[model samples]
Target: MWTDVTLKQILLITDGCSNVGTDPVYVAQTAREQGVTVSVIGILDDGALGEQGQREAENIAQAGGGMCRIVRTIDLSHTMQMVTQRTMQLTLQQVVNKELRQIMGEDSDALPPDVRTKVARMVESGTEEVDLQVALVVDVSASMTSKMPSVREAIRDLEFGLLARGGTHRLVVVTYPGPSGEDAQVLRFEGTSVADAVGALRAAGNTPTGPALFLAVRALRDLGESPATSSVRANPEDREEGRMRHYVV
Candidate 1:
């Protein structure tokens, strides 16, 4: 039910009770796996079990990969409200970062020469910015056949968004065909601007991610030494000194 809805921050409160095994941690992990940052509050002074409960709470927080605060309260209601408010504020901050990345596609040093050349005209004509060497590797096996349309739409939306930013981001797409007996075939995509890349992609293969990723890495490494890589370097000074920044995205 929660997958369809987007949440920024999720806070879970537990009254460090001895009976509460790892439920807090379990919920927090689930929330964060869906891109939610989780916070926890341990309610101390609940009863004779407060100390034990507190320790369990702290352990749960660590296990869940979140921060925890101990609350000493006469009335549990007020403590819960405070924790809720704090969680909301943290979640709001996450939303802001998401918006920033949506606008800029995470900052990179410079555009490679090849990428720069493609976007040079666009930039000269007033394009915003572009992401370099963006690869969308999809696992398209037989099981995913029914969901192809949704996957395609998601990819299309991403393509449009990247192009709309307008600098000179290049795209590479590859789909894996499933294993046949003991052999697998690989599909490789050429690096190009987002528009052409998406238009050329079709899903009719198995999901051989391991081999595909290896090829993608090799192709990216080869391109890293090209003029395109130089042009797209984050800073001209770095390039002048023969410095290259390799990014793994």
Candidate 2:
């Protein structure tokens, strides 16, 4: 039931390797489904698209449905540093777009159709350049353990989906237990990298929603607050309690 009104503007930094345009495209498309934007930025600049890496950057940008800018850092050391710093900064900005009232707050009755879609798309177009964070919160109680593997499979598919898209789409996963006797433990913590996050989601626990919700919030908060933090967190101010629930068999 957790509905995210905030959308992220991603900045995809790339080296035009095996994944290249694929990652950005995947993020843009998937994020658009849930409201996120993606943009591309070429750093190492090694691709067949253009001279001096201009063409590669442009293609990456276009593929992500955003404007692409190429930066020329001195060498590997500087480039890595710049990429890390820039990615975090861009991720922060994306977080903002999701929750910011820059365009219009939740109170607005309705937005013009085309305009609303455009605004949403712009936010999603930047999914590639930044470090992508996808948090999957599942409900798993004793009654649900029989189906945990299916749920896990679904999430695993999501991971593959993000990886197939490439870039730094980090996945953070958690599961809430039902009220039955056995369900009451942390499935995953926020800010845990994709691999570790997935590893933590073992199937057995009660759905302690109150703590589970907060756990998810704390996980992301640990990663460093982002603009999307307000909209994405477990705040009564930003989200209604029912906005984060999901049922699976």
Candidate 3:
């Protein structure tokens, strides 16, 4: 795995409950163990997500070392972008703290928390160049059909937001219980945009969230194990710096 990557995240977007396959919360814990941060967004339109669903979402996020939120379909895009940016900021702070320890040694503790935070943000802005890899996991269960259009729009917004931030990124889309009954359909875009691919998503079938997560984790791990990643990690210059990897569903 790419243990040296700066950040890893899994964003799960769903509207209803998980009724099939392995326990998603347990899978989230496993993902966290493997250095993947799992965050969840529960869409509450039409009152589809009940108390149980909310609890599950919260539990999964907690177990995966991330945050969980319940929001309307209309707010999905903004919420998703906020979560991504916040996670990245925190990861950067972690890297900054590590560097402080190396530089200040025992004297690092003398720095105030607010001062450290300010310096971390400044350092991250100037020095942290990231190679961001994201896996978008979306729930395509029957209950999510009506929200597909909004979901598609939200994805486009997310893409644009990332572009505006100015970084190198690779975003892949994965839908649970994919078209052919596979655990999930992994879609990679070439020259086309993510919105175009999202517009083609048809919601149906069961929400095998656990299996879908497993597939995403595997894909991200494969990316970390790729030859390109190996070459980057092997370079002495790159070895001292960190990159970001994420799985967002």
Candidate with best TM-score: 3
Residues 1-249, candidate 2, lDDT per residue (tens digit)? 113222233333333321111332443454444433334444432322245345645654454344555553224233323433354345444454444445455311255675445434433333332345544434443444443444445455445544543134444444555234432233444552343453444444433433443344444444446433221222122222222111100
Clashes of each: 18, 40, 8
* Model 3 lDDT per residue over 30-95, tens place: 998998878899999884589999998999889878779899998999999988777666655555
User: Roughly what TM-score does model 1 have, to 2 decimal places?
Assistant: 0.33
TM-score of 2: 0.37
TM-score of each: 0.33, 0.37, 0.79
Off by over 4 Å in 2: 1-121, 128-130, 177-205, 225-249
Report, for every candidate in turn, its global Cα lDDT versus the true structure: 0.40, 0.39, 0.72
Question: Which lDDT value does model 1 have at 139?
Answer: 38
Winner on lDDT between 1 and 3 is 3
The alpha-carbon deviation from the true structure for residue 11 of candidate 2, after best TM-score superposition, in angstroms, is 23
